[model samples]
Target: MTETADAVTTGTERPDFPLDRRRCPLAVPQEYERMREENPLAPVTNRMTGKPVWALTRYRDVRQVLGDPSMSSNARNPSYPAQFHVPEEMLPYIAFPFPAMDPPEHTVRRRMVIPEFTAARINKLRPRMQQIVDTQIDQMLAKGGPLDLMAELALPVPALLFCEMLGVDPVHIGYFRRYAETTTGRDSTQEAVAGAIAEMDEFLDELITEKTKNPGDDLLSRIAARLPDEPTLEHEDLVAIARVLVIAGSDTTANVVSLGTVVLLEHPEQLAELKADPSLWPGAVEELLRFLSILDSATVRVATHDVEVSGGTIRQGEGVLALNGAANWDPERFPEPDRFDIHRNAEGHLAFSYGNHMCPGANLARMQLETVFRTLFERIPELRLAADVDKLSYMFDAHAYGLHELPVTW
Candidate 1:
């Protein structure tokens, strides 16, 4: 017989907790508060398509779920309904790569990327990251007052940094931008997303071909050189590898820059303190990352078998979301999770996440932000948001997160 209403797991059936939960994190303006109060480990029906999902709101629970081995991220199952409703053009490509893979296959492909992402290796990109940041600052200063920080500082830093790391021409960042924005966040029509993916594939194919003949000192060339040795990585696998590195390399950090700037602006005293003491800039970057941990879902993981999680139970083959933002805000971890203090030792925040699949470009991201922060304060000491704080745009309502635009000026 079919499971009756009384047969639902736990004492009571999960409340629908009907939130818009559309292309954004969840419906309703005060989401963080509601999630914390309504259900620390709240069970809610997937409002996007009326499916079932467990929304882990508390910081401890989110971390436990993310780090848990039982959770699985396989999206190929026919029975598994879509957890997010994204524009057709961007849906196929967003939030895949290592974040969505299970082990063995995941481990195989990720090995090619791990060494390249090591703290030592990424640190080598520091000087180059500084150059890109300095160049953008010069341009922004030339424009005088009233500039869109997103365009002036945020976009260019990562765009140039990623292009350099990939050994591609920055002039063609527009190509990646279309795909990045559509898939990472923002809206894209079906045709637009499809075309973007096709174009991206074509770009990757050509890049791999070019790198094949003339490998450079960059990560792309290194990954390509290593690909032949790894039995699991195929030509398509190479392309997928590059696809995520480029898109994520550009998008995730750009959002950090965009949103982090706003955070600094919101707290001017902290901004002034950071400007006066450059040593505090690194700490400031970490604090901003934790405060505005824009990337909504830390990582998408799935269970290989049924497992009992922190305090809840997730059946095997189930999808789980880890909240980097939530963990950063855990009072147990941070003395005052909500308070933004640059002086605070913010090194432990999982803004970059932890595990074998941690962000490959975290060093590059930190470098870009560091350079931007140093140069920006030197240039525009009075930098502040031009638009009302509430008017700023948020990102990746589906499975991902960040900002759309951060309109700021001196």
Candidate 2:
């Protein structure tokens, strides 16, 4: 492997976590490739905390760290590697509830809403999801092209679908989308982040209260109904759950849709193969998810006990970042990892992570992606970028990596 300047290590100095990839937004940081080859469990300084932590780069080591019970996901822990450095007072409002909880609490909280995202449950919503996607595209077509796809379709389709799932009023979708962008955007001020969190909590609190009095056929309503039977689940807990769902279910999927479209458009030969053979859609979506590991850096934890991984031991009280992007790009697991072949068996990629803390909304996200890609290109076969690829702005400063805008034409 050709060693890039990013991989060069000297003395005992550690590189900052989340190596810069602005040079190639669509690709994993080349530093990860070197770390995987030389130091599978390389030490790095947390950019947020300014503390040293272990960064797991290989697929096996990342899976191992994620599945191990000794690794703690509690954000309250001083050692947990937080993506953003929020004030301690604001942690409760900002930190994701279930994802940052350690089981049996995490298990209990996750199980409360697990049925809502099952393949069976999400499949039942497929019709409505398709309708939502179609409506967004119809609106887009009416407006004509030479417009930002991110604003027209990529952002709204998933936001509308998530609102439908959570029984959130469609009118409030715009606010929710803004809240997600601000809270997750790296450049957002602390006051802005806190305000967004407060606004979300207030909205969810009201929604949950309404659900209790007039329950609906939605996830939040169902959770509200359980409050009478389950004393452990509080009203705030319901709000927190819904808040996380809104952020995860919408923003992440929206990113995948926009970024994935760029990938398909950039690879016309593979795009033609997909358009010609509908059977490849599912595999194409998986490949896209694998290729663009947007949420990889979010999988972080603090070792509660000494844990042995591929490279070395992670002693208790030390933070560890299991970079899913790096693992997906690890050539040890995937040959020619940089290549984006739709037919590659990209199963077991850590895009949604693995084990207990695996993203519960993964199935729903996949279905939405498949629907968007299948319907999009079929409806607009001539869809192509309106501007040069280099001119496109990317969300390198956001918690998730994606295109800031995708100007397209047909």
Candidate 3:
């Protein structure tokens, strides 16, 4: 691996933890590389607040910090590293999802929905998922000519799947999509986000009420069934879980699909190779996830106890963020990390994160990505970008980095 010649080896602290969108669409922030080498536990100021927090960069250091129980995932803790500043008025909507809860709370909450995303459950959904992919492709093909794949395919597939998973009516997808987009949008105001949250909670509350009376086999129904027995899993808990699952299930997967398409198109040689070998699609999906590392701020924690990392101590009550993108791109972890190799064994990359709080729907995401890429290539062998790469718009401020629209034609 070639050395990062300009890596900072002294004067560790940087002002902002995560540098804004890189000039090059596919490149990682330069600050990450410098910090990984010089200051694995770099102290940086959170952009949302002027408060200081530790940003862990190196692969080993990041992995250690995430798995360490001393690093609390409880967002209720005031020291928790929030992605954006939450206005005092919006505090009621700050309910902790399973991912943000600590210990027994997280474990109990996680188990409630674990059955829905099990390997068997995902396997059962595969046939329907394929049909979803085919139907979307059919619509795109019928429309013909220059099309935005982001609108026509990537966004719809996951959104519709999420609707199906939650037993939400297809007609209400527009409402759901709006709230999902705004919640993760960097440009949205706290008031706008709070409004979205309130609207979504109101919707979920109604859904839960309906499910309680007339239950189905869908995820919401299952949660409803558990409500009577699981006292901790109350009405509000169910609503919060549903909201988080829908937003996460739709947003992250959609971004991956859009960004993955961009990566494959940019590297035609690799794209062609995958097209020739259908079996390679699964590995290709894993590689793309590892290579992309779209959700840069997925894992943030506050220290519950003084934890020593790379010779420094993260004192109790201090906030920390594990830079998953840096870990995925670390040369020590992924050799020649910058090279986008479809066949690379990227099994352990931190794309879905690691340890207890690893993304619950990781398997579901993998299946969707594999099916979408394979089906797309098989259907449109000549597909290429309709717009110039440099001119394309990207959602730089989004929690997930992805193309705003990928204009493509066959």
Question: Which candidate gets the maximum lDDT versus the true structure?
Answer: 2
TM-score for all predictions? Answer: 0.85, 0.95, 0.95
List, residue by residue over 270-325, the lDDT tens digit for candidate 2.
Answer: 99999999889999999999999998799998988878887367887888999999
Candidate 3 local lDDT, residue 115:
88
- What lDDT tens digits, residue by residue, belong to model 1 across residues 1-410? 12221235566555542332333321222354556665555455543435555555566676666666666555544223343344435445553465557677778878888787677877887887777777888887788767677777787788887788788988888778767776643235556655676778888989898998999988789988997798767777888788878777667777777767777777888788877888888888888777766664545555566556444566655545455666677667777777888888887677777665567667767777788777778877877777886656666353345556777677
Model 1 poorest 10 in a row by lDDT: 20-29
| Selected candidate, larger TM-score, 1 vs 3 | 3
Q: Per-residue CA lDDT of candidate 3, range 1-410, in tens?
A: 11121232346445765566557777667677877888777777766655678888888988998888888988777777777557745455577578888879888778888888999999999999999999999999999969999889998998888889999888887787787778877777888887888888898889999998999989989978987877766788888888888778667888889888888999999888998899999989998988888887778888888788877878878888898988888999999988999879999989888899998899899989999999999999899999888778888877678878899998
What TM-score would candidate 3 get against the native?
0.95
Candidates 1 and 3 compared: the better one by lDDT is 3
Q: What is the clash count of model 1?
A: 13
Q: Which ten residues in a row have the lowest lDDT in candidate 2?
A: 1-10
Residue 236 deviation, candidate 3, in Å? 0.9
